[model samples]
Target: GGEGGPNAGGERERRRGGRKDESDWWTRFQNDFPWDEKTTRNVVIGFAGMASAFLYFYFRETGKEVSWKDFVNNYLARGLVDRLEVVNKQYVRVIPVHGSYLWFNIGSVETFERNLELAQQEMGLDSTHRVPVIYGSKSDGTFLMSILPTLLLVGSLLFTMRQGPMAGGRGGGRGNPFSMGESKAKIMKDNIDVRFKDVAGCEEAKLEILEFVNFLKNPRQYQDLGAKIPKGAVLSGPPGTGKTLLAKATAGEANVPFITVNGSEFQEMFVGVGPARVRDMFAMARKNAPCILFIDEIDAVGRKRGRGNFGGQSEQENTLNQLLVEMDGFNTSTNVVVLAGTNRPDILDPALMRPGRFDRQIYIGPPDIKGRASIFKVHLRPLKLDSSIDSEALARKLAALTPGFTGADIANVCNEAALIAARYLNESIIVKHFEQAIERVIGGLEKKTQVLQAVEKTTVAYHEAGHAVVGWYLEHADPLLKVSIIPRGKGLGYAQYLPKEQHLFTREQLFDRMCMMLGGRVAEQVFFGKITTGAQDDLRKVTQSAYAQVVQFGMSEVVGQVSFELPRQGEMVMEKPYSEPTAQLIDQEVRSLIDAAFQRTHQLITEKRDVVEKVGRRLLEKEVLDKADILELLGPRPYEEKSTYEEFVEGTGAMEEDTSFPEGLRNWNKDQGMEESPQEQQRKQCLNTVSHA
Candidate 1:
């Protein structure tokens, strides 16, 4: 019995513990509903306003109207009527001798007035003492209601203004009326992994910029030696030559903030806005010290000033002035390096190119064969190549094939190759894919549906065959790669060639290029006895090349080693630096150069007439002929390699010659017989020579 009693007590205690747990949970659940002070205040304010409105409306609605008979008998008979008021001529407010005002629904003001007067007269009440029935009307707050709408409109206007251009938070630039002067430069401070190793080609440019990076990284080393860091560098090159990429790589290498802005970003519709933006950009660069400020297409804002009075001159001039001031301002100790890129260095303002501004002008031209190979290797790293492919050999082959190709063009070729492989459902990119990509990039997409007639096909075949044969036979001409008659791009035919990877060209080399360019026109004249519009582009190229050689290169004997070409201005305006007689001589020289090249082409094609016909026939049948097919049809070229690719790879082939002139001006001076004092010699070299790619 005692044990059972203990067990019953323990059971009761267990039930109490369960109940306590359940109560704790209930309390926590009730506390979980959040009610912060801010939320509570807002809720209370909302409820208070709603209640005030509700009570006011409820009290007004309680003023119910009495019956008309009751009003006349009880109120009028007892002389208890006090006054009456009208609201908007719609409803009447009736006032009794006692209690609150009651609403009297009436038909019209005239009827109500008539009824009131009759009742007053019947009751024998005077106008002054008989309840004093006032003729005043009740407005029912209509004026206040009318004014409420205007107040709402004003409030809306204020709200829209607050949320409009005056509101500053991102996207407040030229288009924003309130922030027209804000700088559009984008800041990149981190996550930039592009280093010098990733950027290919421009070896000379890379070496030139490496010192700047060292100056930034180890400034004390140079400062101790009393050498001031260069203020800026101007990257001048053709478009797509990797000028902008080199700047990015420099920033990455220096591990500093990169502030980039386009030159056109400074221009605005409003005056002084461009100058303001320039100031703001520099201020931002100053804030982030030891950073690189890269201005892409700087020529857009840095054009030669005072050329002419125009619409945008005032604003652009102010912008250029601000840029000049910022480049060499009093804040020179900030360690900020400015990098500007443009393809038209000739058109830039002279002040912008002077020392202490853009102190270094690095030229990044098209890559040579070895540089192109390195570029190919860099771009080919991520592509899924086939197992059998020799990447190094393929890179060399592509480099050899694509001359005058910039870094951007090579990257595009690599992407195009991958897309072609995917379209053909290949597992990996193959050599054929790369070959097709090169053709596509150089010539353009093949217009397969552009059908030609039999006569047109034969004419096109003969045209391409002429180019191939002429270029193959000429010693200094580019080697023929392939010839095609199938329509591609805007042309009816094309002949691809492998140009030598040479920077400096002699007069003989330029003449050979001109002769090869004229071959197609000569062929058309011989076969059809007339030339068509097909030679329009060919004629344009030959004409430009001949004029460059004469007017720019000083290759013409009549020019006497004097270059009469004027410096490039902003645009081609109506201006001639020379007299009418000199213009005639210039035209005559251009004509003579073209005539000589045409005669040479005619002679070459006339001698090889049978070979042209044979090559043309084969081109018409196959629609395309690669190097191997051309070699088989016309026999091997005079400069054919005695060893194969395997032999060369095995190091048993003939040694390659060094074509570069390391001695530069000295070698060129020796070739051309001229001697003068040092001062005059430098001027002559600068005057006669021009940069050619």
Candidate 2:
């Protein structure tokens, strides 16, 4: 079957070829070169189309003579002959072009001969009619041939311009402006305006700082005396006590470079940044020797290291370590001093308080009376005060009003007084303004026009008047300064006392003070016939005074000469020093003492009923009183008495009566039963009757 199939296919092919159509060759050609396989075929097709156009043009120009020799000589022979000549000479020949182009045909006989000979030898062509060369000069086109080179040049120029300013290499040694981001420690050589004289009420601290300043200025003098200058001084004190001021004053007076930084600034979230900054700061300070580096509020970084509750310590520990090493490692001859200030000295690390580091701790405490006066004088210099305003008297009043106020507090008071005077349109700050300022500072701004009912006003007036009258009668009590029913701050009324400058108080003084405090309640019971809650403050004050006298001052008879008070340790709150049972006894003693004082006040007021009523009535009418009004109403104080007991007896006719008595007076009186009056005889008879029964 397979052998028959080949003969059958041959017979079919012969029959189909015998009956072939006119499109058979075209169809066979298209089958060989299909549309999908035309990528290489397209290039051949394009070249064929160009050749066809050229042939058609050549055929159309039939009258024109064609020179094949010229064509070959001008175009093909120019490249081929140069290569053949090199081959013949056994060396490659190099051709040079004038300017930017080569000249192939110059339209001259010599050029034709040279080209003709070259083409004859290279192409083996006789001098037959050759294709004529159609030579054209190189066209100078108006458009660019390639744009990549220009674009590259422009891009490079832009990059250079952008980098020039940033790299800082274009304009001399003016470095990159962005380099300033790295901050540096600034050591101030001048412009320290604060001096020791400007600081007030810190004489002891100032003296301590002055010694350090002197050491810095003349370290040789101290060295000659075998004294080592302190490595550092820590200014410890309550807030607003001029610690910072003293540090600045030392820097200014010593004429040294000063670097001021807060303790908190050395701490940061980044772990090692703090220590890095600490090293940088000290390095700068050392460069500027004879300098003072002041760290304000050092406790921010100097807290006792182990107390931190977090599992890991703060970065401030690293900073503190750096500070310690820098301070102790530096040579003493370098004259670089570290001054630190902290209100909380107790929480500082023990190592910081050692002999070589912070060797001296100067305490700046609250100002005393004299210090307050000096502080007032310094602050009052700028204020426009009235001529009649005596600073000493004002200072006395201020010292009494402010128990724990510091120098800064006094300055604040003076500023507030000036502001008050300005608010009232007064030309100068007066004593009244100063007083009001003190009240404002102590109790806060007064709530004016807190209107009360007539009954409440009467009660407040009587309540305050009671305190004043009792205090006036008690010799050991503070002298009454003023009593006011005008509502100020939280109180509806208040009574002020001219506090003495005494630092210590006697037992009698404490007793009199307690009685004076109880006077308000006593007056309420005596006049109103009932007590009111208006005596809440008075009772509290009396109770506290009595307890202080009995337990703290050891003034009570039951707890004689046994004080239970402990020394103050700053502002921290803690348990009482005394035991529970001792506290109970103290409480009982305090209550008994206060009760006795109240009884005494009640008796005294009852004895002077007329005087109490008079004072109360005047206070209610005026709503305020000065010391003059109190003195005029209560008469002179008991201490003002100059007369002795003998003088009193002689002046009262007692001595004359005694001298004139009869010699037999005693015998005669016994015989006539004259010794006993009728009242005495009745008392005797009653006693005898009771005894007989």
Candidate 3:
């Protein structure tokens, strides 16, 4: 009994084990899902088989369709002797003995039978000799085959969802194909390399940004003082100023999460996509609290709503509305600092620029002389320079030469200088390279191959020489540094002038500047007995200055103290604030001022004919003349003037800030421009050991 019981129990256990083993195929299939290569191959093969069956059954052209009349007149009447197959009780298929089969649609089964009987009788055939009409039902196999591909496609998508690469950790990584409204903002966990000292020229804007960084680092300090952290700050400036760089510096210094998204990223063709993206972006910022959220080029979405919105709701307006709401919804204790950068603050929506949303509106204009010097020092650190080069002195010299350069322009100059040095295979960047770089940035690439005729060259030389001589002698005129007859950009020649670093000017200064602008035309008229289009830029400057004196500066007696903004060329103005007679008087005043300046320039050039003649001959012989050449020939200016390098820096708070270089650039190699620090060297050696594995 014991043996029988044990054997029976063992047999039952083996049967259960066999059942589990039989089910393992489905279990394994479920675990691997669509990721199993064999399973995927089987699925593909099955789908292909079904598609082939569908195509073959549905697209067979042998049994072509025909009208009911054609089938009756051609086949049954002629006694071509074919059998009829009625399919799905809706159509009849005729099998001809000689050729291919033809089918025709029918209205009703009873009507079809009656018509066939009548046709047989009309053809005068007996029951035995009549065409055989078979009756049968055709299934909906063709209809199912026609829709099989769509069904397979949907099934394949479901199979893929089980194990898909598209489903990233966040249920589809930013702007996910599955989630179209997801935020595409780039998130950084304080991984930025930029610091405050790396950004230069916009020192005042930097201070306001620094306050945000300080608040992020120590929120309690401000909270204890009964002060609320600013809701946001908008950095508005002309392009190429350090607006975006300051924002990055704030993020770098805060040592917290940073999320940056461009304003244009929120724009979409879908009506609600933009607003949804704005919501997702702000929610993401909240998720990483104490982070800086920077929106670059905010003017794209922040323009005043309804100004140009004609009909339907604008997606841009919706985004701006959502952004306004998001900013207002910020909790005071949440340390998400919102910073935006834009060049067009004038067109921004009033709600966006309100006191509660963007509490601070910082302006970053083109850097002054001292600000440019600081920017130069920051950009010039990586280049190989001679040991004899005094960095501070070089910075000051470059600052003076670049009168109205922004921080971006200074960086471009430094990089361009290096490129020029490399073009000549030089070991180090020199002063001449820097000078060429500045001219390239200002006047564009020199067109040395654009050869000129002798007469054209001579005319250019005299025209440029006239400017040098006039500016050299006039007490209030800007000093001339160089004159060249070599073609650069669109001009046949160019005269570089060291314009004084002064903004507020007297009537004498304005008049002298105008005469200098007209000097080239005066010199051309006097020497060549004609004028060329080479004076277009000069004439435009002269005209603008003249109008500035009359309309902008209110230096005209007829215009009185009223200053009206000049109407740009394509802009439309509905009405003038002053009467027509007053406008005529203003025009008369402008004409008189220009006429007086032209006469003064003509007289000045006439008196300095000898000096102009000598300078023009030198310019033609050398093709280029520097400040030293002019100083040696005609001597220095007689007026007491402030040196352009010293005055802009003396009392401006820019010098007190430390504009130091990062470690790699601070102690760069003397000869090879390599890093001199051991840590950098070790890092490089380690990088060299990594094969392209």
Question: In terms of lDDT, which candidate is strongest?
Answer: 3
Q: Name the regions of candidate 2 deviating beyond 4 angstroms.
A: 1-187, 267-277, 308-325, 387-405, 529-533, 539-579, 640-693
By TM-score, rank the candidates, best first.
3, 1, 2
lDDT of 1 by residue, 149-234 (tens): 57656754554344333332222333433365668899897778787778877877876677676666567767788888889999
Worst 10 residues of 1 by lDDT: 655-664
> Candidate 2: lDDT of 38?
31
- Strongest candidate by TM-score: 3
Better of 1 and 3 by lDDT: 3
lDDT of 2: 0.68
Backbone collision count in every prediction?
Answer: 0, 6, 0
Query: Candidate 3's C-alpha lDDT?
Result: 0.82
Instruction: Flag the better candidate by TM-score, 2 or 3.
Output: 3
lDDT rank order: 3, 1, 2
The local distance difference test score of each candidate is 0.78, 0.68, 0.82
Which 10 consecutive residues of model 3 have the lowest summed lDDT?
Answer: 664-673
Estimate the TM-score for candidate 3. Answer: 0.76
Off by over 4 Å in 1: 1-178, 310-313, 330-332, 566-570, 639-693
What is the alpha-carbon RMSD of candidate 3 to the true structure? Answer: 10.5
